[model samples]
Target: MTATVVVGAGISGLSAAHQLATETSDTIIVCDAAPRLGGKLHRLALDDPADLDQGPDLVDGRCGDPALPFTVDVGAESMLARRPEGLELITALGLDDHRVHPTTARAQAFLDGRITPLPPSNMGVPTDLEALGGFLSDAGLRRARAEVDHEAPALAGDVSIGSYVADRFGDEVTDRLLEPMLGGVYAGQSRRLSFEAVHPGLFAAARQGGSLLAAAQQVAAAAKRSNDQSVGSAPPVFAGLIGGVSGVITALEDDLRSRGVAIRSSTTVREIRREPGVDHGGRFTLVTGPVPAPELITADRVVLATPAAPTARLLRALAPEAATALAEIPYASMAVITFVLADAELSGSGLLVPPGELPTIKAFTYSSNKWDWIADRAAAGFGAGTAVVRASVGRFGEEQLLQVDDHELARRTLAEARAVPGWQSARPLRTRVQRWGGGLPQYLVGHRDRIQTIRSAVAAVGGIAVAGAYLDGVGLPSCIAAARRAVADL
Candidate 1:
């Protein structure tokens, strides 16, 4: 029997292995550098309220009960339901009944020292300018209204999102509106991010040379029409499991184990080399483990489901051009601070903080208010007056802000949360801080072209393919889609 090796046991690699197992008879093996399996899809168990004083590290297993009532996702909380990959995988794992959607509560944005309702927008590009009265200043609103009059030729090539939006609307729109939305998703800077990679629909519309306001309105109308035409009342924009999004990883792991796939952790692939004139058993040899005594594994096929830097290192000798292109991709680091508060009620689902508006936190998610399951679990676990909230900090080029220890980080984030309009009286019961260093990949200008170059070079090398959040999109579904494509390519 032939064998295949998948490096990096994140969602992408695991998904690839599952596909290969289901379709072919190849002996599958997955290896990850970290001791844990799940990459960004991490669920942290909250200590029982009785053990609050013990500390964050003393989890439920050590304290009161192993089955903690409240467990929250520190990475991604939801997946885009519009994409079929995530939902299909969930269904395949027999988790359809466990699926849940966010409540009707809308999100808010903190601007000018006040929390205001977020206007109807296509990714922060306001579709309804009339709704932005209080959100924008008088002069800023006028400039935004004058977007139709600004005449310009069709877009020639890729450009930064901030530059394009500011040219059409104004600086305020980019700063107050666009920056916060993009930051929440990528922890990246708007001016440095690519327009083509971030907003492909808007980029295509801009290529025709017309009013962007009108283009945004048309796009929103198209989306509404598509939803109305669906078989039933339109599906929710996002979906999550009853317990946490990390439950998907758990279910996936169980399914993989049943298929007889080998899952190994704390085993890093140091390098990959292709042997010339070898065609019988396997051509690619994977060097893994420590430099002192590295272990070698042979495979007929290989899938690289890792971040840009490590992927570059592995492909340096085999595909230098691809490695060089992958190395150019940059990454951003951020931290998520989860707080369990007693005797407090938050109004909206969450509030986003534009850069410079707050000291550290860029956004806050009222988890108890957003998901019914979380509310029920929190009330049952702790008490009726308890609540759960998550505050996100750091951004691209803002590594210094996260250099402090966890205690200092949590203290700073909680202090800012109290200053928010409705959270002044929140008393912290338990707090957990999760830092993801070099977590998100930044799609700089001409990112599409760079991706093309990397893919072409890797294809030329043969017997190997790359998949990650950096390729197509940063969402869970996108990573899965990239993994499936890599499997198909092989």
Candidate 2:
């Protein structure tokens, strides 16, 4: 049987391999440049391994207490509960029972030197103007009101979310509200992000007519009607696993192995050469090796589920047009600093900082307060006095912040935490900094058309498909859906 090769072992690649294993008779082999699986779904243990006293049972003060291992996910932390793809995969992997939802969905907005409750928003578009009087100036509120009274601008095709929103509501709304929420997810500036790609339903609503805020209200009303159904009320907005999101990776790997899928790690593919009208019709030659040694693996079908840049490089030979389009897709690097802090009264799930407000930290998650699983682990491993909090630092144009050493980054993150209420005097017991080089993909304007062109070029090459956070939505559900669709195309 001819083997099908997947060239990345991220959730997308693993999901593709798993789907192909079930749907097709073709042999599947997954390869990755990294030494371990779970590209971004990485977890770190809290206790020191070298300390003899620090075993799995290393609780801070209890001898016979439940010795649960304390681990913090440094990568993708949560999945959208409403998106069925991720949950479906979890159920298929027998991990549906381990699913968890946030205890508190509330979040704070740290802006203008104070932390206040984030008002109800439709993807960062505030529904209530009067409530926002504290944050917005009289002039800003007037501009926002003018958006509804003024005729909607003619948006023929895809446009940058920032530009469109700024034009509609004013720069204040885009910078103060939309940018933070969009930036927290994509790490890309809103001015460059595709409005259609990021917010499709809202985009459709906007196209109908009226202001952006009016569009949001209309879209939200329709959503409310849909949420009246059985499926919508079942799950929360976000959910995680009992252990960590990494559990999904482990489960996927085990399932793939059970189905006889060969997983190759620490193997980098130098190039992929498509051989047409050759032996057995056609096949792909994956030039893979560590160094000083080269190995060629032939595959009847190939899947490129890598990041934007590397994927572009691999496609340079087979499909230059696709490579060019892929090359234009840029990425942002970031660091997640996990701090073990003393138990403080931190309500709400997390806080998002407005852009240009903080130099180091962009977002903060009160892990223990947000997730019951994390809280239980913290109580079992350390005691009620201990808490877990993490701050995400770095954005698209903020590469300089990541240049400093991890120690300095952590120090800066802790200092930013002081801006949050009740965290002023909090000190971190242990600090763990995870640096992700080229972590998040930026979905700039024209991203949808570019993705279409890239897909068309790759499709012309035949027997090859590309899937990643760049093409699909930048979330676990979106990636899972993209991976499934990529494999189905074969």
lDDT by candidate, in order shown? 0.87, 0.82
Candidate 2 C-alpha lDDT tens digits along 1-490: 9789998999999999999998888889999999999898899876543232232221233332334567779998889977789889989999978888889558887888777777667887767766667676789988876777878766788888988888888888888888889978988789998998899889888876677777788888777677658565644888898878878999999999999999999989888886656743389889898557889999989999999889999999888999999999888999888876664667678888988677677888889888998887777666675678878888898898899876667666766677667787675555678888899989888888999999999888888998889997989999999898888766
> Which lDDT value does model 2 have at 311?
92
Q: How many backbone collisions does model 1 have?
A: 0
Q: Top lDDT: which candidate number?
A: 1
Clashing pairs in 1: none
Q: Per-residue CA lDDT of candidate 1, range 410-469, in tens?
A: 777877777788777777767788899999999999999999999998888778888899
- Worst 10 contiguous positions by lDDT, candidate 1: 57-66
Query: Residue 180 error for model 1, in Å?
Result: 0.4
lDDT of 1: 0.87
Worst 10 residues of 2 by lDDT: 50-59
Residue 422, model 1: lDDT of 73
- Over 4 Å off in model 1, which ranges? 49-68, 279-282
